[model samples]
Target: MALTLHGGRPGTDYDAAWWRSVFGLLGECFPGLPGGAATAEALGFPWADQTTPFTLSEQGRTVAHVGVLAHPMRLDGRAAVVAGVHAVGTTEAWRRRGLARRLLGEALDWVDERFALAKLHTDLPEVYAPHGFRVVPTHRFRTPPQPPAQVQKRLLQPLRHAADADLLRSLLRLRTPASNRCATADPGWLELTVAALSGALSSGFWHIESHNAIVALGEEAGGALILDVIAPEPPPLAVVMGAAGAADRPVLWSFSPELSCDRAEAIPTPPEAGVLMVRGDWPLGEPFGISPLWEH
Candidate 1:
């Protein structure tokens, strides 16, 4: 009699109040909440009807929320494209309970089998392993980018309201090819992101001609500034150097303690590392059962 499950998008019974609760819960756990109402509103996100926001309620009141997005991710081999997970959270009052587990189980059941892998980045691995999640040690890079000198840059940052959904979708397709994450980015996603990004790390977008897609988040501790999602061949440092500019502005990236690539600098710390976990199937497709055809 305590729990009842239902499907609701972002602004149903799960509107601003519910989101306020969820974001506050995150603020308690992490250093800061990345994209919340304040940022979303400023960015002009069309949040009343955002996609991929599903909730779990108690007596019709939302207690938990999580959703998926199929953003573009780069992989090692010929794994095609994939969908990804984003903005997953549960209310603080509902913590330590099996509510999240239940919600995710139900959510995955409907993710069909078209995905090569169901992917999500998480700092908590032990909590997810019991649900058949595996660990792929990964890095979350953050740096005060140093854009090339005399380089031309553009500042056409799009908020959620005026965001190009198809273009963002296309970018995701190009970024994470083999992922099975549903697309969580709507106008609101970018709206919220752009709004939050300007203040993100005190450094904003540092576009480098035909080279990078740089952007910033708010001036908070947990905020992030993304420099580039370049081809494997491009110099990884292009983003860092570009974002921080020639002055070496404050910058950092989160890389798993066990993961490695190329780093001329390191700020190794336990809290900085993260493990990637998938709640459902990998290469999320029929063989694994997480495709768009069977969506919830």
Candidate 2:
């Protein structure tokens, strides 16, 4: 029995059965991933139009899959298109069948015709290296603990309401690059960033009314981890500290912050989540960082 290959933009080419099968495959491939339907409903939208998925189905059940996110970004103050490959997986029963490789080749062939660069974050770099992908140094930015400054912290409201989601969507639409060095120019990836964080980190959404920013933040023994800052303009470090109320503690920026690299220490990101891999000429020769949250 041969598997059938299906491809299309989500919501456009994928129907109800396709959603169930693909989302089911995703949950099986990655533990603790939120159900796609619920996440989309919470945001009052479907998947982004830029995302195109390819799946291998055996008798209507999706067994292997690969997703391509058309990421439009600003790299070193210029616009670039990146085909972000993600969710490449095959069921255990289908392992060693070369199903994933087939889908990957198909996806890449499509990518080559349209985009110059391609990227993906994976725990298994060896799996993709044969496809001409190489790890690129990724980083996190950090700032020294501030002297206890007395400033009224802004109020932070959890993103639990429709209005909160809408606010984030609007900001992402007009958002300035978190860093002129590297940042997403389109809102789709940002929206997916929040959607993907919908489960464990869903509570991390913090709306700073004063600064007009939606911050994805988490707490750790080290200090606060600002995962990604979504705002028209990346808020000043002071504003983020005030909003997070962490003026006296060291702050780590998972995403590139607006602050000068001189002020924030840049360190190589751990490969715990998988190394960042690329497939073409990366324009940013200088040190730069994009939030892991932006990864699919």
Candidate 3:
């Protein structure tokens, strides 16, 4: 039988059997990681509206795949649309057949027609270099913890019910980028997925009533870590820390706190941490880290 190529949005185009095939492919390719489509479905995330996928199949079985997630982002304080390439994989039986490269070519050609900039997170930069992606430097912000500044004025509440999730979903829709340098405007889906996967969605998500913000925070042996912050207008770092009960310990930021860069040291992200690659003229500035919310 001849091989076939297919393209569509995951939410709408994928039927149950089709998803099973994709899931099987993902299981074979990714091993222990949760399938992206399954995770999104479990969380009621609207991925079909956000991502476009292309696949190659033989004998009604998916053999290879590539996905592009469209994102509204802030690049150098300017609004831009970015294409996030993800989920590239090939079935074991199809290895060395160039199926992955073919799908990548098709997906990127589609990206080039509508988007000027594209990005992907990967440990293997060599795989993508020939396709126009180059490594981009990223940094994490760090500051020593301080004593409690003042009595907390804001309250942190977890998403305990459907109402809370709804509230969080609403807030996410209105959220602005935490950084004007390089940040995502709609990070809700990825944020929720990361939280769910890390077991933080239940214990770490907190909504600040007074400020109308949601923070993914956790206390670790080393310090208090702020994973991601979602708000219409992000409050000052102190306010966020105080509300999340990080007033007295060292703080590490996974995302760029664009406003507070001067107060914290910017450290080069070790190569083993993760690699960021880009395929367009990168915006100029001190290298900024994207929120883990964009990690997909």
Candidate 4:
């Protein structure tokens, strides 16, 4: 069969059956529904119009979905913000067939005109690197023993959802100006963020809303937390840095060193970092994905 590309329309976010089917396929490729859901919601939903879902189909069948989100947030407090790109998935049958690369390429092309940088988290570095993406570091904390700064923490207050058009528009307006920081923060952006926080996957999750952010992590038995922006985002770093502070130390992880301690550094180079590749206007210590949990 000739490989075909189909773009999901505005109203076709996906029906319950469709979502179930897609998730089922993902469980096979990635496994772990809750974690996959958490990652998917964080990455996939951010693209597509707030109420809409961005999907790709092959010969009338939906096989993959990748999100393209653009709003103004910067890297290192610069004027450019990363064109947030995430959640590229394909069915098991589609593996090694170039489906995800094609789908994500479309998303990247769409955002290229509007933003200066692109950022995402993926274990697959070689896959995205060839597509113009450079890998950035994905951070996980050992769960710092004491709050880093102690500014005062407020978890999950409220942000607009993907369904709220007016509010969603407002959020985009607020998010897409600076391109150097990390991640996209639009309305549906926050909805998916909050959605990730609702399940068991949210155990180490923290949404410091007063900081205008959301972050989740699954700590492995080895004491490393796996963090890939579970929710939308928190307030400016300056705020969260003050209140919540870092978790515990003896921490070995991926994200920016600022999230850990003055002594933070990289963990083992993930196979995906070199494969996925991340390129941005701002310089990241690594190229996987920047964490919204702590300010760098």
Q: Who wins the TM-score comparison?
A: 2
- Model 3 agreement with the true structure over 127-147: per-residue lDDT tens digits: 799899998888877754555
Model 4, 168-215: lDDT tens digits are 334434443212234433333543443344332224435444444433
Cα distance off (Å), candidate 1, residue 259: 19
Give candidate 1 regions above 4 Å deviation.
8-38, 41-50, 77-81, 139-202, 209-226, 229-243, 246-271, 279-296
Best-to-worst order by lDDT is: 3, 2, 4, 1
Cα-based lDDT for every prediction: 0.43, 0.71, 0.73, 0.46
lDDT of 3 at 68: 90
lDDT of 2 by residue, 1-296 (tens): 88999765453676666777777887898764535545654564455344688889999898998988888788878888788897788988998989988998888888898889999888888888988899888777776656433344332332456665666677777777677777777774444544454452355667776667776676544677776677776666666765566756766777566442357777777666467899988877766777766776
Off by over 4 Å in 2: 8-11, 32-37, 148-159, 192-195, 198-201, 258-262
Q: On a 0 to 100 scale, what is the lDDT of residue 139 in model 2?
A: 77
Minimal lDDT window, size 10, model 3: 149-158
Against the correct fold, how does model 3 do in TM-score? 0.86
Q: List the residue pairs that clash in candidate 3.
A: 145-249
Sort all candidates by TM-score, best to worst: 2, 3, 1, 4
* TM-score of candidate 1 versus the correct structure, residues matched by position: 0.56
Among these predicted structures, which one has the highest lDDT? 3
Instruction: Give residue 109's lDDT in candidate 2 (0 to 100).
Output: 87
